[model samples]
Target: MNLKSNYLLFLVFLMSLGCATNPFTGKQTMAIVSNDQLFPASFKQYDEFLKENKVVEGTEDAARITRVGQRIAKAAERYLNANGYEGYLKGYQWEYHLIEDKTKNAWCMPGGKIVFYTGILPVAQTDAGIAAIMGHEVAHALANHGQQRMSAAYIQQGIAIAGNVAITDDESRDLFNQYYGVGSTVGAMLPFSRSHEAEADRIGIILMAIAGYDPAVAPELWKRMESSNTPEFLSTHPSNSSRIAQLSALVANARAEAKKFGVTGFTE
Candidate 1:
């Protein structure tokens, strides 16, 4: 086989070998970097981040962040165990911290390390609101979005390499690179990321409901975020309006799902 053919075959093999099923969605997703590799790196980075930032503790808001985070984590475990994916979170060293930052952001790293920015606490006005945010962040980790993103990036790079190798003409290769970069990002990567965000939103609501937090608060929380949202096509996350609409529609379904787990009450 020619070098180009060899590269293509290797790409296919790489893709075929590095896949894992998402228990929540039951879809095979890319996992070029396994959790075994991703988690330690994530933990290290999280620790570095905490060291660089002021972590709020000994305060009610900080306590609430940890409280909500633990509840969300337990809710995820319950859902996974009930679905027969017991021990799915083994090796996950869950930690939650409230960072004193002005950025309205909160994120959960691969190994369940989470940080909530103090700036967002006002937006996440209540425990249920915090649960909404916590659930969404935890859902991203539970769904293995980080691993999938890294794997997808590898595929994108691999395809670019194959294209550059196949096209012998310098001019053609340059043009191909330009178009491929924009086309692949806009057409494939953005949509993939948006889908992950939507899936996290769906799963987040269910988790918050099961954790005894009102899933209905999810939409309200998004409403508060609407002012800062970018256009849907250009952003990694769906538009806040879109998230609000989706969460609003899913509230009843989330409550129903929680009821199956004997969770009949929700805190507002």
Candidate 2:
């Protein structure tokens, strides 16, 4: 078999063996790197980041970040347990920190180390809005989006290497590199990332609703994010319009889901 074909077969084999079911989505996903391995490494990296960055604390905003994160975490635990996936967070050591940064971004590391940037606070505007953002970031971790992204990166690199090995001519290789770079990234990786973002949005609204935050606020947050523009096809995340529309559509369903957990009222 050709080198490209060989790599394809190997990828198929890896996909067959390295799969984990996401409790939230009830879908099998790639997990070449287990949480046991990903978590410790992520924890160490998070610790190093904390040492390097100015982590905001001892203030209302900082406290709000932590409070919102804890509520989301509790909602996750409750959802998992109620859905027959108790102890799913066996190694999760959830930690939330507010960092002093101007970047409008927040992220949750693989094992639940979350950092909320100061810049995103203005956009969030309220405690419930903060919960909307927090839930989305946490959902990324819960759904193992990091693991899947890493697995996709591995596949991308492997395919590049296989193509290099199979194509010999200099001109052919240059053409291959030029096209492959854009094709793999725009076609394969960007769509994968956008899907993850949409999934996180879907799961997050439900989580925030269960945690007593109004899911309707979620689309508003995304509408605010629309000012930061990136074309949907080229960006790692779905377009702001797409996010707002999806979250808006899911709000009623999220509220209904929250009602199942006896959460009737939501903060706005």
Per-model TM values vs. the true structure: 0.98, 0.94
Question: Over the stretch 149-225, how does candidate 2's per-residue lDDT look in tens digits?
Answer: 99888878877877787788989999999999999999999999999999999999999999999999999988887
Each candidate: RMSD: 1.0, 1.8
User: Clash pairs of candidate 1?
Assistant: none
Residue ranges of candidate 2 with Cα displaced over 4 Å: 1-12
What's the C-alpha lDDT at position 247 in model 1? 93
Clashing pairs counted in every model: 0, 0
Q: Write one digit per residue (lDDT tens) for candidate 1, span 1-268.
A: 8999999999999888678889889999999999999998999999999999999989988889888888899999999999999999999999999998899999999989999999998999999999999999999999999999999999999999999999999999999999999999999999999999999999999999999999999998888874644677977888877888899999999999999999999999
